[model samples]
Each structure stands twice: as C-alpha cells, then as structure tokens.
Target chain A: MNPLDKPYAQLALAVLAVLVLPLFLKSGILATEILIFAMVVAACNLLLGYTGLLSFGQGIFFGIGTYAAGICLTRWQIPVPVVLASAAVLGAATATLVGWLSIRRQGVYFVMLTLAFSQLFYFVAYTFSGVTGGDNGLLGVPRPSVGGTALNAPWSYYTYVAVCFVAVFAILVMVTQSTFGRTLLAIRENEGRAAAIGFPTKLFKLEAFAISGAVTAFGGALHAMLIGVAPLSNIEYHTSELILIMTIIGGSSSLFGSVLGAGFYLLLADALSTVWPRWLLLLGLVLVTVALFLQRGLWGLVERGYDLVFRRERAPETPAEEH
Target chain B: MTDIALQTRGLGVKYGNFHALAEVDLQIRRNSVHSIIGPNGACKTTLFHALTGRVRASSGRIELDGRDITDTSDDDRVRLGIARSFQVTSLFPNLALRENLRLAAQGRTPWQALAPWRRAEANAEALAIADEVIERLALAPVSNRLAGELSHGQQRRLEVGMAMAARPRVILLDEPTSGMGIDDIEAMKQLIRDLGRDHTVLFIEHNMGIVMNISDMVTVMRLGRKLVEGPPAQVRDDPEVQRAYLGNMITGDIA
Candidate 1:
C-alpha cells in the first residue's frame, strides 16, 4: 500500500483543531507534551524510515536544541524565536559535519559513528560546568514570550507548541511529497540501483540526515521552552532509544504513526512509571510483543486491517494483464 | 561517407596482472548496426564497458563522435547519449515497470548539480516516452506489473525499454537476447532491427545466426584484442574467424 498517499495535510489540520480544543478543556498541558514528542519522533522518522538510515544518536540534536534554547533564555536572555531558529540551524550544521564523516560508511559502521558523535555531544554538554550548570543544569529558563504576550499560562504555552508542531510537520510533509521525497524513496528502495541510475545516493542520505537533525533540534528547543528546563537527561542515548521505540510502536514508515506512537508509548510510560516505578520491564515486554506479533506497528496494522475488511474496494489492477 | 560514431586509439585495460582489453584500436561508423562477436572472455564485454565509460582504459583515448570522453563517468555518458543495458536484467524490482522507465526518462532532464530532480516538461515527456516504449516493446499489457514479477523475457524487454526511454542516439546493448526463448528472441531481434532505424546500435551476441541476419558490420575479438572487422559475410568467411570458432576445423568451403 502507498502509505504516503494518506491524507496527511487534511488530517494534520484536523488534529491541530482537536488539540486546540484541549486549551478550552484545560488539558492543554498534556496535549502540548504529546505534540512536542510527536515532532521529535517525526524528525527521527525523516532519516530512519524515509531515507533508510538509522542512527542511535538522534537524541544529541534533540538535547542540543533544548540546551541551546535553555542556555540562551537563562544566560544570554535571547528571545524564543531566535533561540529556536538558532538552535535548529546550529543542530543542522552539526549534523552536516557529522554526516560528512559518518556517511562514508553504511549499515553498522554508520550506526556506530552517529552513536559516537551523540556521546561526544553528551559529554560536551555534561562537562560544561559554568555554562550548562554541569550536573545541575541551567535553571530559570524564562517562559517563551511572543512580541507582547507572555505565554505563561498552560493553555497559551500549549497553543504555541501546538502551532510549532503543525508548521514543522507541514514542511516535512512537503519535503516528503516533493521531488526530493521521490528521490529519497528511490534511494530507500535500493541505494545501488539509485546510484547506477544517476542519483547521488550518498549525497541525498547526508542532506536528509542533516535535515532530520535540524528538525529534531527545533523540537528539542521548543520542549525546553515548554518545560522551562534543559537537563542532561534529554540528550542521552536512552532518549534516542525512546524516540526509536515511539517510531516502531506507532508505525515508523507513516509520519502519523510516529506521533501516535509517541503519544501512546510516552503517555503510557509516564503513567506506569509513577505507579510501578520499574515499568522498564513492562516497556521492554511490550516492545518484544509488538516486534514479535505486529511488526508494522498500530497504524500500519490498522491500515492493513482496513484493506482486508474492504476487499471489494478496488483492488490495484495489474498492468501485466493488459499486456 | 566518412562518418565516425566511435574511435578508440590503443584502448587498453588491465585488471591487476591480467590484461583484460589489450592495446586495441577500432572505428565504428555512425548510423550503423555494429555487432561485437567472440567466444567467452574475448574482451567483448570489456570493449562495451569501455565504450559506455563503465571501466577505465589503462592508457588510451576513446572518442565519441568527435569528442574525447575516455575519462567520463557512466552517468555523464548516459547524458551524452550513450545509454546501456546490462547483460543481466537491471530494472528496479520494487518499482512498477512504468516507474522504472520513468526514472530512466527523468534522467534526461538536466538540473543544477546538487539539486534534486526538477519538474521540467521533461517529466511529462518522460511519461509519454514511457508509454511509447511500453507500446512498442509490447509491454503495454504488463506496463503496471512490478519489474520483479515479470517473466525473465519480459524483464529483459523492460530492461531494453528502460534504456530506450532515455532517447539516446547511441544504445549499447550487451546480449539483449541472451536468455530468451525462440519466440522472445525473434521479438527482441525485430525490436533491435526497428531501433537500428533511429539509433546507432552496438551489441554483443554469441548467436551467429542472429548477428549475420541483423548486423551490418561485425567486429570479432579474441584473446582481449580486436582480431578482425568487416561486413558480416566477409568476417564470417575469414579463415582466421573459422579457426577462432572451430579451432582446427578450418576446412574446405567453410572457411
């Protein structure tokens, strides 16, 4: 099934409207959290599923983004827009440099280099005692404010985060639907074939990775603005793992699946950890079950189910018969 | 009358200690069906690779039309109207047959060096070319079939369709009818003959009957060097050709 053909634009607007309704319900805090996490997972999806290159270091960009904003707000007294934009650009440039080196290898080597780079970023952020506050992290990251209005209330802050998610998501979708998107899809199908047929497969992969890194950092910056904190925990490999699992459980190939997975998995983990405190075992168990049974994740599974239920609904006709 | 499509001067290629294509020189005429015929490992494929810029020559210059492109990459050669079909089926298995053809056609549209594909009138024209190829190749019925799902002969046809969709002036085919059945072989022969009207075709074929019946000229290679070149009838009757093919049976009227 052509997953990209799904009505993402219309559905994105619909989801945005539904999320805004939470502002009225006063559940905007949870809704904003869901939207932010969705964008992070969606950023990871840009490289992982679309370009077919998996990195274990996506959290570096996310953490860096958050820290960029967090440090700027607390120390530099930078505005939220500049902070977010600068963080994203910085992350993108960092990603480009990493890509220039890491892209020379493929498969396990690619994973290893990205992981190494992520760890390097983590240590840099961790050891900076004066600026990053070291283990304590920077505090008093002022709430993100627009031109005149300070988004101090949960409802107002959530609205801002929600709007950011919608815009980033729409752009990502445009990228996926454009000529760049089709070329990446070709690269994903078979890198060697794509190269043989005049496509610069390696260059495409690197550019895509850089784009993913930048987007992830943007999401991270926004998250820092929302929570008013940027701690060492945000950039760890475990954070990267969490986003990967979110992509897996919600259907990695589908953009919406990433969001759904982020919501379901994170919200579930958040609740379970508060109650049981050792929900890692349960989380691991759930991941194992999903991998074993429903490999495509919930959305893909639902999509397959839809196809099966509607068998009479215009089967894709084979052109071979016409020949 | 002195039109030259290709000219190779001392074209030599070495793989480690082995000389795959020794110092060889040849001129292929423009608008002619030139066939390269030889036994296994006679450097026929190597010559084709050299022509298409897939392999580097050890120390030689290769001129296409009138320009030197010895150091040009395969992709650049493709843009310069030298398109090729691999000896084996090279169509993308994941994509539909038409999509594969579309990709081939889309390569014709030039764009900024690092930019992704641009939507030129070329894209629509590419689709139109794909439709024409599908119809001409008798692939219209199987045009929507996944390339992997096609029968071996159909896949071979699709491979040719992919190369043809480029609208190249020069088409390099390596055994286009290698594994086809008699009926499919005939169809392929007919298609190649039809292509000869508009393209400068250079193919490698072991099937002597197909070569003599279709090729205007034949270049025979042996032991990594060009042994002879002439009209098919003349080359077929050469004593050296008979000795090369039949070993010691160069007897009587056969030679």
Candidate 2:
C-alpha cells in the first residue's frame, strides 16, 4: 500500500511542511499565507474532489469570515477564540443557504448558481459601506495575544497560524476518512445509484458544503489577522477563482495535494511577480501546461516519482468497460 | 393482502404527450421470482422506474406490504424496503468492490451514514453485510479491485449484489443478465433462483431460457401495456404472449 494512503502519514507530511517552510522562506508572512490558503483549498477539495461539486461560492464563506473577524475585532475587541468560532459559524450558515439554493440544479447550472451567489455577496459587502467599510474595508484588525505578549513579529504570528492549520488539516483529514466522506465519494461516482441504495445524496452534499464553508471561513479570519486588515478583495470573485485554480493545480485526489497546490501557486506568484510584471501571462501558460500534461497536478508528479523510486513498476490501471 | 409484497394500480407515466407506461397494474407475491419481459421499447423499464419512484406516475398508486407509498421519494423507497438495480450497470466505478457494497449496506442507517468522526471501517454491521454479499456473489476474489475494473459479467453480478446489500424485502433488478455469456447467465440464473427463496425478486430480462427456467411468475408487456401475466409455462403458451413477444423464442428454447 502507498504510504500516502495512510492518514497519519499525510498528517506527518503536513507537520513537516509547516516546520520546513520557515527554513526556506525569508518572509514569515508569505509562509503563513500558504498555510492559510492550504486549509481553504482543502475545504474546496471536499466539494470538488470528493463530492464532485464545482462550487464558486467558497469566497462567500471566506469573505464572511473576514468580515466577521473585521467587525468583531475592530469594533468590539472580542476574544480571538470567540471571533474565530463566530467566523466558522457564520461561514457555515452562509454556506448552508448557498449550498441549498445552488444544489437545486446540477452540472453547469449549479456552477452558474454559485458564481451568481459570489457576485451577489460581493455587491452586498460593497453596498453596505456602513458595516464593511465599503472600498476601504475594516482596518486595524489586531492579532491575538498569547499569555501577556503580543505576537507583533511576523514569525511569532506564523506559529499561531501554524497550530490552527494543523488542527483544521487534521479535522479535514478525519472527515474524509469517515463514512460521510466515503458516501461523498459514492455520490461523486454515481448519485442515482447512491439514491437507489438509500443514501440522501443531496443532504450529504449540503453537509460537505457546510464543512467546506466553515473551514474556508476559519482560514479567512486567520488571513485577516495575518494582514491586520480585512480587505474587500477577500470576498471578490477573483478570490474564488484563485482558490479553485490552486485546488486544480495541486490535485483533488488527496488532502495533501491541496497544500501542495496552495504552496506551489503562491510561491510561483511571489517569485515571478518580482522578476516580471507580466507574471499573470506566465501563470496562464502554467495553467495550460497543467491542464494538458499534469492533469492530476503536482501531487500526481510526486506519486509518479515515488512509484519510480520504490516500485519501479507502474500500478495497473483499471481497464475501462464499455457501457 | 399481506401475501402481496408489492402492488401497483393504474400506474401511468407520461413525458409531454407520449405515454411511456399506461394503466399498468401489478401484484408481486411474497418470496417469488417475478420477471418482466417484453420486446424492445415495450415500456418494461418504465414500469420498473414507476415502481421504484425513479419516474413519477401520472396516475394511480404504489404499495409496499399493503402500505401506500405512492409519494415517497426514490431514496426513501429504498429505506421502505424497495431496492433496485439499473438497466445499465451503475456501481460506483471508482470505489473498491467492498466499499461499493459497504455503501449499499450502510444505506439502511442514514444517521450513522453521516458520522464524520467515526471511520467507515468502524461500522461493523455494514462491513459484515458487505463481506456476506461479496461471498454470496462469489466476488471475493476481486473484492479489493475497483468496480470499473470488473468485467461485464462481474459488474452485472455486483449490480445485483449492491441491491441485495440493502437487505430489502422487495428487490427490483433491471436487465440483470443483459450482457452475459452462457456461463455467466447460468450463474446469474442460479443466483436469482436462490434470491427468490428470501426476497420478492422482480427482474427484467431478455433471456427467455433463464426466465422460463427460474421465474415463479412472469409478466409479458407490449408497447406500454401488459400483454399477459401468469406462471412462466402458462404465459409461454398464451397465444397473445406468443404473438406479441415469446413467438418463436419460447418454442425455439423448449424444443
């Protein structure tokens, strides 16, 4: 059996990545962002990879979390734990509503519904300047203090985000190993058969959405703290696209693939943006290459490497049967 | 009557102006192998769809153990003891054969199906049912293989096994032997014969030999209506059934 198939092995890799990022990168802030996005992207994978729902409304939950953190921290100075919890709850509530409405349709129509919801949310945040601070966003968000000392340094705050990242990653891993996760995969494979076998597939899909929304929101709140501001861009359509792109580039087959995708995209952007202003064009070329050659993303490459090194023989592919 | 495991009255399904099935009445007896047979486009599959709630009936009602379940959702119908396999094989192609069976076994308990904290392997009851199904279907050799990797015969048997995993009182199998060789057909025939001992098995088939050999009762259909229904020997001998369906096939097989 592949070592990566084990949950403990995957978790250990996550811990290793968290420990190693600081050693290679000079910017603690960028390292923290990779961890935050990793959690959010993995949440997206629960829908896209496991449940086969290509949701575009993940940014809605993520943005809601940012606003939750922004409003609570800037105005009320609520405890960090409470603020984080509220962000997750609000994200879940919003996701439930969106998932319920969007899942009423399937295929392209479902994708359209989520995209429309993303736009609607963006406008709501934009129009409600009184609460969301309109274009300026809600600024002056403070990082949580540990004991009596404030995590004023970027590296100190990276430690805080790293702990949350591990917890969230483990929870997501647990969910995928559970019966619910297996059912989600079943639904992804054949929903009609699942329903015939007596599984309420729609409810399961909605529950996946809820979990994805909660995790994405938690990541959003962390991002707000990482930057010390909840920007309006956090809720935009572009944010949804970026998260989806990372999910695709990393591969959806495994949870760790999500981390690889987030890290790869961010690190690539950081490197290219400094050297060339036309970095997006280069990114487009990368996307095409991934789509054409690396369909399973970076994780597929890693799996191929592992197979070559250890097994020296290709795993047998399941022969397709004609209908 | 309690002897009737499943019953449908005045069942009809319409798509726009076309009537796929009309005025179809069926009474499937308890613990009998009931087979529905017809020529192509005879609405045989349409009847199974209406019975299993895959397609809405424009008129009339369906009952399970004499209880009205005309408005029940498709998934709820499975919980209410009606499970069905598709005309086209529809197992979860990406999942292992064991996991596919386990999902079906776990379907009866929806609350536990949503247990996110507990591992899927922890559901001992479901695991046991899956293992029993694998053994019963003689799929133990390839239990760990992906469903998509199975041959047409194995997939067909797996299709029936998945429905059986639900432990449903009424099992509806659509074309359980649509595409099988001689040996596969023999195995499936014996499997269906055994299934009738415990389950009220309703199946659709084109294999006249297997149908006549195993079915306790048979319903012949033609162009969205029931042509005739009786014990296999009686149905085969009926002039209307011979003219509409059985024709030379029945005589060819018996002779």
Candidate 3:
C-alpha cells in the first residue's frame, strides 16, 4: 500500500506530538532545536539521499539564510515573513551558482568542489566583520511577532517554528513521491542509463540543489530568530559535518529518517556533553556502529523491525515513509 | 536495396594516435535485420558508439532517414527514433522490471514527468507499451521483480525490451545473445527475426550461427575497416572473411 495515503493526518498528529513534547521535557529548547535541525537535515536529504549528490557546502546556504535574515531584521527592520522569504531566495541563488560549477564533476570531486565553495563563503563572511560581525556574530536577532504580538514566550516561538517546519516537511514529502523524484532515483541508480533514456540528469540535479538550498536556508532563518544570533558556527565546516552525520544516521533518501537522525544526534550531544567533556568520542563510536551495521541508517532498521514483526514480505524500497 | 534507414560516410574515430575506427562506410536498409560481425578488435562496438553519438566521430557524416545527425547528443539520438542497448546489460537494477520499461516509455513523453499529480494518473500509453513488451518478452511472471534479480537471459531480454520501449525506428543491439545457452540463443534469434519485420534492427554479434541465420544482410569488419558487405549467404562465401577469422576458424562451424 502507498504509505503517503494520508499526509495531512500524519502531519496533524506530528504537530500534536510537538505540542505535548515540551510538557514532558519541561524545557522547549531541545524540542525547538530538533524542529529547526530536522528541516536542515531534510534539505540535506534532498541532495544526498534522493539525487545522489553529496554536497558538503549545504552549511553555506544555511549560513547565507541566517546572515540574510539577521541583516534584514537588525538593520533594515524587515518583518518576519519577508526576511525569511529573502533568505530562501538568497540561498537558492547561491546553490544555483555552486551547483552549476560543481554538478559537472562526480563522486569525490563533487564533494571537494562543494567543500571548496563553502570555504569561500566562510572566508567572505569572516572578512566582512563590519556587516557579519565575524567572530562576534549578528547577535540579538528578534523572534518574529505575529500580527502585533511578540512571540517572547518559549511555547509561542515553538508554535511558530513548528508551523513552518510542518509546511516544509509536507512539501518535501510530496516532492519525494513525485515523478521528478523518481527520475532522480533513476539517475542515482545509473546516470548513463538515465541519460540514454532521454533524461538530462544534470538539469535534474540542479533543480534538486536549488530546492534543497532554499529549504535549508529557510531553516537557518528560523534558527537565527530562535537562538537570537547568526553565529559563525552555523557556516563553519564543523556544522556541515554534523548535518551530514545526522543525514546518514537517520538514513539517506528517507525524509522521516532525516528528522529521526537530526533529533537523535542533537539530543545525544546535548545530554552527553553535560556528563563528559569528550562526549564526541562516544558519538563517533556510535556513528561507526551505525555505518558498519546499519548502512541504511536508523530508518532502515525501523523498516527491518516492522517487516520482522508483521511478517509482511519485504518489498522494494519505496519513497514513502512507514510512519 | 530498400531505402537506407541509417548511412555513415567515412566514419572514423581516433584515440590520441590510435585509430579505433577509420574510413568506414555502411548502410542499414529499412525493415531489415543487419548484423555487423567482426573480431574483438575490429571496432564493431566503436561503429555502434559513433552511430548512437556515444563517441564523436573524428570525421564522418551520419544520416538518419536522409537527415544528418552526426553531431547529435546520445539522448537526442534516442529522441530522433534511434535507441541502443549496451554490450554489458544496462538497467536500473533496484527498480522493478515494469518500472524500467516504463522509464524508457515515459522518456518519449516528458511533459507529465514534472507534474506529480499527473504522474499518478496512470500514463495509459506508457503502461500499454510496457505491458506489451513484458508479454512479448515473456517477462510477465517476473515483471514486478527487480531487474538485477532476474536471470541473465531475462536481463538480456529486458535490455532489448527497454530499447523497444522507446518505439525507435532503428534499434541497435550489442550482443543480445552473448553468454546465453543454446536454448536462450534460439529464443533470442527468433525474437530478432520477428523484430526485423517492423523495425530497422542493427546488431553486433560474435556468434556466426545466429548472425548468419537471422540477419537479412551482413557487414564484416577487420581492423576498423569494412572488409565485406552483402547478403548473409554472399558474405558467408567470401574467402576474405575466412582468412580474416583466422583462416576459417571463426566461420567454419556456421558455414
């Protein structure tokens, strides 16, 4: 059965879960972090999982959105929705430029090209400390007000981020279930065969890159408003590495996997850092185990478990999520 | 001869200092199964590559039904009613057999591919074509199975089925019966013979028995040059073909 049969109902339940999550934790901070980063991981999933293009420069697009939102809100006094829209546009434009130059190459070269382009973005932002505030970051970016009321409370901001998160998530799920997405899967399987069948694979890859960049930037914009700073750390290589790790951990090509991955990594890091100074060592070991044992990531494990318990004949991998 | 479906004039390919194919001229008549048989180094595959625009000819003019398409891209060649199967089986292994054929069929009509809603509307034309091909190739039982999981013979049939999915005026088959047993070879030979009734079929084959049996016309190549071209019987009787194939070592069994 097609798993995407009732996306609206699934989304409503998801939103409901987020609404009650803060009650159990007593702090909405981690929940908010999960929501924002889930969007980022989903964007990464678009390129890496679906299109089969591993871009290490996704952080640059997110950083661009964060910086753009910060500049608009702090200096120009732009409203919330407009700033977010501008950030998305800026991210898409950068991704288009980078994708055009990088898509010509494949495999390791593709990864290196994106990495180099991101470094270029990082240095550019670093050099313009006057505008970017460099190491100090663009601090005190305001949480948006909805129709004259400031979203100062944690729950209020969580509601705002959750709404944005759900909308983008639904859009992504639709895309993955689309014909264009199938073509991307075809390209991922055999690019030569895809082209021989009359698909312009490069053009498809570019479209994927643009869409992924826009969503990631939108997530970054929301993140900046939530944390009250457009920090340099958002653009750094380390952030890119973390996002890539989350994508793999959740499972490549699975959208729900993206959310599961981002939340798992973020929560683990948050909880572990309090107990140990070198918490990453444990995280690294966990990642190794996941990579070695569960190549499909946590999502594949979930599917395997579902198959075993239900005793349903395992079918070919479909784009839709089970949950 | 009937009207020329495909013609190449002085087609040549150079790799640095070596000549992969040189000074080759040929004609593939409409609605005829033409087999290009040669040794491994005779550049039969290179000639196919040039025809499909997989590799640019260093010097040549390729005409498809009276229009020059020497500079066309591979995918454009497919659009212009030309399709080819690889020497090695090329398929989307993870996808179902039906989906592989559907992908090929859908390539002809790409307008609906971007519209996700339209994609689910059941592309009747593509589905019909895929269904017909699956039945014709006897892949009905395994239609839902992944292409990679199929037996080698089934995979070979699917590869050719994918080429036919394009509804090409001219279909290129590179060793369709390679590595098949006697039974599979006979089946493939019958399929090619049937295919010749409607489509301009061109193939490269190492097996002289199948080529000599099924092909209406044959071209023999030696070291990137056309050594002989004529009817299957006429080419089979040529002394040059015998000497070229290690003095009757290649053609002795078939003739």
Question: Highest TM-score among the candidates is held by which one?
Answer: 2
State candidate 1's DockQ. 0.34
Show how many residue pairs clash in every candidate, following the order shown: 4, 0, 0
Candidate 2 residue A259 Cα shift, in angstroms, is 0.6
Task: Candidate 1: give the clashing pairs.
Answer: A319-B141, A320-B142, A322-B141, A323-B141
TM-score of chain A of each: 0.92, 0.97, 0.92
Give the per-residue lDDT of model 1 (tens digit) for A263-309. Answer: 78867876799889889889899899889997878767767876777
Evaluation by lDDT, superior candidate among 1 and 3: 3
Clash pairs, candidate 2, are none
Candidate maximizing DockQ: 2
- In terms of lDDT, the poorest run of 10 residues in model 2 chain A is A314-323
Residue-by-residue lDDT tens digits, candidate 2, B1-255: 599999989888998999998888999999999999888899988898888888888998999999998899888988889888888999999899999999999998877878789889888999999999999988888888889988889999999999999999999989998888888888898899999999999999888888888888999888998878999889988887777665776742532
Superposed by TM-score, candidate 2 places the C-alpha of residue A157 at a distance from the truth, in angstroms, of 0.6
Instruction: Give the Å error, residue A280, model 3.
Output: 1.5
lDDT of each: 0.78, 0.92, 0.85
TM-score-superior candidate, 2 or 3: 2
User: What tens digits encode model 3's per-residue C-alpha lDDT throughout A1-323?
Assistant: 22422455435545665666686665676788888888899889989998898999889988998999889999989989999998999898889899999998999999999999989989998999999999989999999998899897888898898889888888887777777777788889999998887776787888888888999899889989988999998888877888899999999947877888988898899889999999999999999999899998987886777667765776755532211
Model 3, runs deviating above 4 Å: A1-20, A312-323, B111-122, B249-255
Q: Per-residue CA lDDT of candidate 3, range B1-255, in tens?
A: 349999999999987899999989988999999999887799888898899888999997899998999999887888888888888999999988998998898877655676543443367888899999999988888888889888888899999998999999999999998878788888888899998987999999988888888888999888999989998888878887776573654552343
Identify the CAPRI category of the predicted complex in candidate 3.
acceptable
Candidate 1 error regions (>4 Å): A1-4, A7-30, A127-131, A312-319, B14-18, B43-50, B53-55, B110-122, B245-255
Error of 2 at B244 (Å): 4.1
